[model samples]
Each structure stands twice: as structure tokens, then as C-alpha cells.
Target: MDWMHEHELRRVNQIKLSLPSSGEEALAARERIQKRIAARRAARTPAAA
Candidate 1:
């Protein structure tokens, strides 16, 4: 809902740049952020389950 559309979430989820270079940069940044989030999520999951 509204919480999911927050600025930080929008920024991480979408690449809304005007130039190609800018878009690439945003994509790279988003990837890095996503990797970190994924790593954290994985670490939180229990291995036995």
C-alpha cells in the first residue's frame, strides 16, 4: 500500500533517470542495495528449516 510506495522504496525499486548513463548508474546502485538486502534476509533465515 502507501508504505510500499515510500520514497526510499520507490528509489530502490525503480530507475527513473533521464540519461542512459544515469540510468545505468541507478541500476548498479539498485543492484548493490538489493544484494545487501538479500544477504541480510538470507542470514536471518534458519538453516534447519
Candidate 2:
């Protein structure tokens, strides 16, 4: 989880630096990263009995 968070942070930073003019673009990037991370976590967890 720590690694995943770090990776997401890195991606966010990259997006921020690459396009410093658009807040909306940054927000969209963050949302996409978050959804991907959430989906990965959900897939890794065991199903309830």
C-alpha cells in the first residue's frame, strides 16, 4: 500500500509538472489515479465468507 501510494503521488507530481496551467487537468489525473488504485486494492482483497 505504501508503494502504491508513493507511485500515485509520483504520477500526480508528473502530471502537475507537465501541465502547470490547468487545475482541471490535474484534478482529472488525480481522479483517474485514485480509481485505478482503488480498483487494484479491491481486486487484491479476499472475498467475505
Candidate 3:
């Protein structure tokens, strides 16, 4: 179990290190995240104010 956790941590760190530093890749990722959040909000029912 401890070994699995260490392997996962290392994998996550490697993925983070490989991510885009700046420019279009980062911008696109940000935009996609924003759109996902907006979609989630739209899907939820609004409560009476």
C-alpha cells in the first residue's frame, strides 16, 4: 500500500512537470475548465431568491 502511494505521487508529479508552462496550451486548458464549470452551473436547478 505504501509503495502504491509512492508510485501514484511520482506519477502525478511527472504529469505536473510535463504540463504546459504558458501560451496557448495553458490558455486552452483554462478555457476548457471554465466551460466545464459553466456547464455544471447551467445543469443545476436554481433555488428561489
Candidate 4:
């Protein structure tokens, strides 16, 4: 519904507004994201013989 789309847009805008603005905060965010990606990749990849 149109209301759902509008609600999601507002949520996305709020998230954008809350994002870290400092370099250190940005670096910490990047590290957390990388760790999550690595964990997901490790889970999906088959073990070597």
C-alpha cells in the first residue's frame, strides 16, 4: 500500500540522519560490516579437502 511505502521511506531517512559522521565511527561501522560479510562468506563456502 502507499502508506507502507511512505513509512519505509521515513524509516530510511531517519537511518540516514542517524548515521555516524566522524571518521572513527565510520571506521568502526566498516569493521563491523566486514566482519559480518566474512562470517557469511565462511558459512557459505565449502571446506577444503
Error of 3 at 40 (Å): 0.3
Model 4 per-residue lDDT tens digits across residues 1-49: 3667887989988998788768879899999999999998898786641
> Which candidate achieves the best lDDT against the true structure?
4
Which tens-of-lDDT digit does each residue in 1-49 have in candidate 3? 3666887989988998888777868899999999999988877746422
Q: Model 2 over residues 6-33: C-alpha lDDT tens digits? A: 8798998898788756787788899999
Better of 1 and 4 by TM-score: 1
lDDT of 1 by residue, 12-37 (tens): 55664434686788999999999999
TM-score of 2: 0.50
Q: Each model's RMSD to truth, in Å? A: 14.6, 16.0, 10.4, 10.4
- Weakest ten-residue segment in model 4 by summed lDDT: 40-49
Give the lDDT of residue 39 in candidate 1. Answer: 92
Model 4 clash pairs? Answer: none
Per-prediction TM-score: 0.51, 0.50, 0.46, 0.49
How many backbone clashes does every candidate have?
0, 0, 0, 0
Per-candidate local distance difference test: 0.78, 0.82, 0.82, 0.84
* Residue runs of model 2 more than 4 Å from their true location after superposition: 1-21, 47-49
Best by TM-score: 1
- What is candidate 3's CA lDDT for residue 25? 89
